[model samples]
Target: MSRKLLPDFLARAHDDRDPSPWLALWLDQSTPLPDPVKTAWLADSSSASRQYLLPFLRPLARTVIVLLQVVKVFFPRNWSHSGALHALLVWGLKRFVSPQANWLILRHFHLGSQVLAFIARNSPAPVPTSPLEPTDIDALRDDLFLKHDLNLFNFVIRLNQALRDQGLELHKPAHLDLTMLRDPDLKLEDMPHGRLNFLDLQSAIELFTPLYQLLLTDNDFWRAANSLQLDETIGIYCATLLAAPEHLVLVNNKHPLVPLSTLRAGHRLVIHGLSTEMLHALLMRFKQAQAEGGVVHTTSGDASAQ
Candidate 1:
């Protein structure tokens, strides 16, 4: 079978809700098993002569074990114990223990990482690392301007208040999972390389709406500096996300009359509203800066001016 068939196969195999029919189908197709499954079967078999028989016996053994567990759970005395035990097992599997053993048995091979990749690609909602799209920005703008009847300036002020009220500091260093950036097994680089979609889009919007409002705000300082363009504003936001204090100084420094020291001290720099290009650029800059041992100092401007 094609590798493309793996996601559907695993999904059906692990459907726990109603697994009997799917398990039967999986067993029926065991004769000419998929390459991964067949290889795994042979590797685990004791003898070459028993290779063919292993395919039939393996899934049957699994089904019988599962059925026995199900039957045990049906008994009133065993129900509570079984349910509690199952819950504990799930918790342990997700948190404390590695899932490698379970994956080997469930997938008929040790392809847990591949299976996760397939599920991520086939998921109904997009992953969090995807970029922001133009429509998403437009919708956010409408929500702020039309629905809320709040101009960019007021919106930003409100966003600042909200941030302060919630005690969320925007200038803090961001934590990232580098593993999500690449797939070592497949030699795939930049794993999530696209515009934000569905769930990711919704989440990004929710998190950044306040920051977007801040960007759209028409402050006299930004207007005088002539750096109020969307791209430039977004660049500042990206810099903040990257913890690039130098870039923030470069962008915000345009308004020299507004003391840098006061702005740095009083205003909390924030990040939001990112496109694919914008996010990529930030990551590249961050890496480059780290490589060169660049030193970044916090903004020294007074916050009251912001």
Candidate 2:
């Protein structure tokens, strides 16, 4: 009977409340990799049994489908770390937000209670309290994340404190990725897409900010920035200085450049559309720049700073 209703079983398991991803789930659980792995979207779609079964399921997983499978197996089996459930919900949000693989989190373990709380909190329209699963949905109604999301500085400070509480971290000079300045070689496959060509401050800095002697090259800079600036301490304020090429793209809000006004007070400037020599000089300038503002002094200072 369980096998007979396996589709519904998976639908409930995924919480997608739809059946589309269920047969894949069943095949996955029941079969080994070569077989389950080979099944594509079409194989699951063509069957009436599969189609009808989808409405009975929901796609609850947000991380790699594989991780949710692990979580599902663990959660219903009375796993201790219920917070992992919340992790999966965050994973699902990540999956929906960008199908790209940039982050390196393997499990992203959250406890189960956290998961239900998150679901209760993040429903497109809030659900009325469910007494049966009170902890699952309603508790997340606490208003913390929506109000005070952390930025790079604050996140780092909090992380340091967390490490201290755990007795793992020490006060030391922190490292960050620095090799983000160089442009990748321009080829048929190497042209800047909107995501790379236009940039946001945090993301752009992360990609180019090489950690522990990570270095960016001219090619990378070309691909990532419209222009480049170097702060005295190896801090950078690269900007998207040029209008994009007309033939390849249209200027949207995501143009791969920054306004001059956004540049920080402490930087060595390289103008847009510079000659190769100018760019080379800018590279030298960045090499000469110091590392960061200074060592993270104290979280108290960070709190006041924020």
Candidate 3:
């Protein structure tokens, strides 16, 4: 498949009202695509976008759709790629710098309608019949619920909207279990080797509690930058995990290593995508912490003593 023919194939799929032929040609890129409509086969990948060159969606899309159909019976939310990543990608690709490529990418992913809806106009907020009156039932419920747990400014704003959407005259929805942690085990927010700042201590405890394991993505040891917020910093490291190895590693962004031992299944260890030497240094620190009874957890699993 050549870039020259991908658009043509898509147009052909639309005309034929079936993706099987398009899919066949799609799969054949490195091989040969099968065309049920015209009873033809094509050889070669249609494009060079690395992702397009791969046969990911070509073979898996139909299977994924079938799985989604079954999962839909049990899950209230949509988990289809179209609903999750596809919808998100639709928004992102629509904003892609190249106008033609944006449209093409959406079409390539079969996200045309969502792209159109996004481009059309702003979504409207529902009009409220009344404000938060002091005597109102909703006002009373608001006092009972959503009056705590969240920062006041944002909390009030979200609570008001949720109350309105429920169509209930009462003020609040019941408190949800979302605020609680599912696991009871002790967790470590890894302090980078350098000296710790007081706020970093606070922020680490805040951010790392929920996520027990981290796979470091780069050569750079994560120093808690006084200037940088922990959330943004942690997010950057986590995003790099896709390129990391199957086993948890502490690596500089460019290289990877296999830790000498396996981690216990439940230990909330942060993984760094790091090299062997760096991994050893970090693991040793864990050992010191363990010997000193600094960390509350232990593993008979394979992770090495640093």
Candidate 4:
């Protein structure tokens, strides 16, 4: 899509009652986007100020990252759970950010919490360190986002091992033996390298933490930030479904449907427009595909089946 026509395409995807057509376009990544078009995509997710300031924020963000590491050494278990810290952060976020920005922030935490809980229940892995089931959107952000990013990181590692042990892939389906997960034999390890690392959860959380208040009404900033959170949540869940046993399959392969690689490249297909609802609709498409025997051909070209 050309830069000149990109906004119109975004409008159609974002505004139309049925966004399936535009969704198809956004999900296709075969046609490499130009740098300008990629910038437009970023702009659609964030403010120009954010885009410009993000590069500059690197140093300060790094300092905050180191500081957080030091604080964790001293307080390990309690550093992130301070009521005052949570309250102050939430007040600042809610008071300074746009409602759209706030929604993106809250929704991803909520979904992340839900998805983690699902994985914990279904996988034969070490249980997540933090409570996976959050009570509300507020708890999702203040508790899950602030208090448990590392724990989520830990859980993904163990879950991957458990899947591997069972002769299964995270993105492919096999009937998981629930009894085996009852006393999972997996061990937590340092972060895995390459694609299995998935999203850089801690760095991503840190990247936006300092900017929440500064971004003010920049919903796009929150959208761009939360989109990373969304990527982790969606990636794991979609992978879980794709690898689901025959009876549980929701998708055959990721391909032209989800744009997993494109999301990691910083495009906003998953977080764009009516995010959560759009995800549900996408899942429904997968469900329909399952009913039709799990074969989906797309213009994006990759047609290898799971």
Candidate 5:
């Protein structure tokens, strides 16, 4: 159930960006080799019938090595060297193996960990001594979403601060509509798709200004960017929402303020349409929260507080 909450955009993005051959080769070379025992055993033997015996044993050895690597994926540690050997063998096999197969394995392992991490971090806190009523759940859900948005807002503020520290500035364009950047019908020729070197200020601005705008203005796009920039944060947010004991349906309920539907819709719109001025205001709020060693709490009845 938690896994289902994992965003589809993440999976699509992962599939779309297949690593270049050069990157694959470099990654293979860069991975550390297994310890000496396995290397020595595979390197050669000095028995009388070694030539005939090794040919038969090599396949079994490779299989065992691969299995060990699969185990290491779950239990990462320095105890065994078989996993290292497995990596080397897999890397070697990439040259002869189908690219699709290699990509599938790499993509699954990498993306699986990301999902697991998201689940771990964002799983809901245990219910209090008194189990939460629907209203309590509603408040908690809204609070979590607010926290997630503010966290992203703070991150951008920090990024800007870092840039300033390095004598760089992030210019917020006067007219920015991120929705256009994400139009599915937009032609590839019109897209800013190319190699970018952030070290060059012009290149950085050309690439990131539009990207930052998109992050600010598009909820789906912002969530995807958050997933990439801060892995599983969005997943955790979704998971936390899904983990709510019961979905609030506030059609004719006696809530003091807005309906749950309105609250939800408005929250989404506010996050998606976040402007530079709003972000700066959020940054200030976050700083104050940090200085006070507490969070800025938003009441369930007052959506404006968020």
Candidate 6:
């Protein structure tokens, strides 16, 4: 039975602009890759590939900066980070990167850190107590950027579906065709490992800003913060889907993800939203869920004892 879980599951308080709840729910609920071995293999392979490939890619990543430098010479002496170049880059991303892939990549950083923060909060062993500032979160982002390819993650999602079609159960062995990823309709949130919330633009910007500073021509970090409208659309769709009252009437129908936003008067910039206090809240919930036989694991295959 599809019972209504939390009425405010997707609703934020009128005064709250905090993006953690949606991001955490998405991380906690993203479909777990079917096998732990696959997870380890992904990490192992991605690490090796990055070590081999980054030397080549680093120069390509630098091409953006070179283009910007040339444009600066030909254009105004006062070309700013928030100027036409930034807009064109954002437009190109929207224009070229598959919408699904774009959403997946940007949200992955926020969700990835949420996964780490969840672990840091729940670890039986003591770890560092310092809050993750923007710089620290940037380090985490850079580490992750070097570790995994998004296409590999996308391929695993397809492989999981193929395994399911063959009646394979979770954690069981299976072999599948790699070509399934070529399907036109695959989406990141379609599988049933758990529920995912939605994407928020600001969350992506928080993690992306540092990389923008390091790789792109925007040496002035403060002025380069930005986001896409696609983030807002996906977020609204997911939030509204879960929050809809129609679920009461159509009890057996698959509920769509839903959306909403609450505007407030105060302004604050969240570098990386994960913090010590947020970790504390996540820890308490993790304990309660563990008591209830629900253990959180990452999509990269950090499984808990069942």
Cα TM-score of candidate 1 = 0.22
Give, for candidate 1, the lowest lDDT window spanning 10 residues.
265-274
- Candidate 6 weakest lDDT stretch, 10 residues: 259-268
lDDT of 2 by residue, 1-306 (tens): 123222234434544565545455535522111221123222323444334532332221112233433444534333232243334334332332111111101100111112222222332222222111112222322321111112222333444455556665222122222333332221212112233222211222222222101122223222223222211101111111111111111112122234332222111111111112122223223323425444321110000000
Structural similarity to truth (TM-score) of each candidate = 0.22, 0.17, 0.17, 0.42, 0.19, 0.25
Model 3 worst lDDT run, 10 consecutive residues: 218-227
Better of 2 and 6 by TM-score: 6
- Tens-place lDDT per residue, model 5, 1-306, is 123222222223333366433223322422121122112212212222233543544454444434544554555333333233334333332333222222222222222222233222322221111111111112222323223335444543454455556674333223221111110121112212123200111111122222222222234323433322222232223223233211121111223222232212212332222121122222233335546767643211110111
Give me candidate 5's TM-score against the actual structure.
0.19
Report the C-alpha displacement of residue 278, candidate 5, in angstroms: 37
- Over 1-306, each residue of candidate 3 has an lDDT whose tens digit, in order, gives 224323445445444455545455444422111132111111112222222422433234334334534544564332222123223333332232122222211121111111112111111222211112122112222321111111222322443465468653321122211111111111111111122121111122223221211211111101211101122222222222211222232222221222221111111111211121122222333335546657523221111111
Off by over 4 Å in 4: 1-46, 63-81, 113-137, 147-285, 291-294, 297-306
**Once model 6 is optimally superposed onto the true structure by TM-score, how far is the C-alpha of residue 269 displaced, in angstroms?**
23
Model 3: runs farther than 4 Å from truth? 1-46, 50-54, 77-87, 94-99, 104-306
Displacement of residue 294 (Cα, Å) in model 6 is 7.4
lDDT of 5 at 99: 25
Best by lDDT: 4
Number of the top-ranking candidate, with TM-score as the measure: 4
Give one digit per residue, the lDDT tens place, for model 6 in 87-115: 44344334333232233333344443333
Better of 2 and 6 by lDDT: 6
Candidate 1 per-residue lDDT, tens place, 1-306, comes to 234223233444455676654345445531323334333222222222233443444355344434544454444431222233334433332332212212222221112222222222322221221111112112222222221212223434444565667666444343422222221122111112222211122222222222222223323222312222222333343344444544433233234233332112111121111121123333433444555667423322111111
RMSD of each: 24.8, 24.5, 26.5, 14.0, 25.3, 20.3
Candidate lDDT scores, in order, read 0.29, 0.24, 0.24, 0.39, 0.28, 0.30
- Give me the overall lDDT of model 1: 0.29
| Winner of 3 and 4 under lDDT | 4
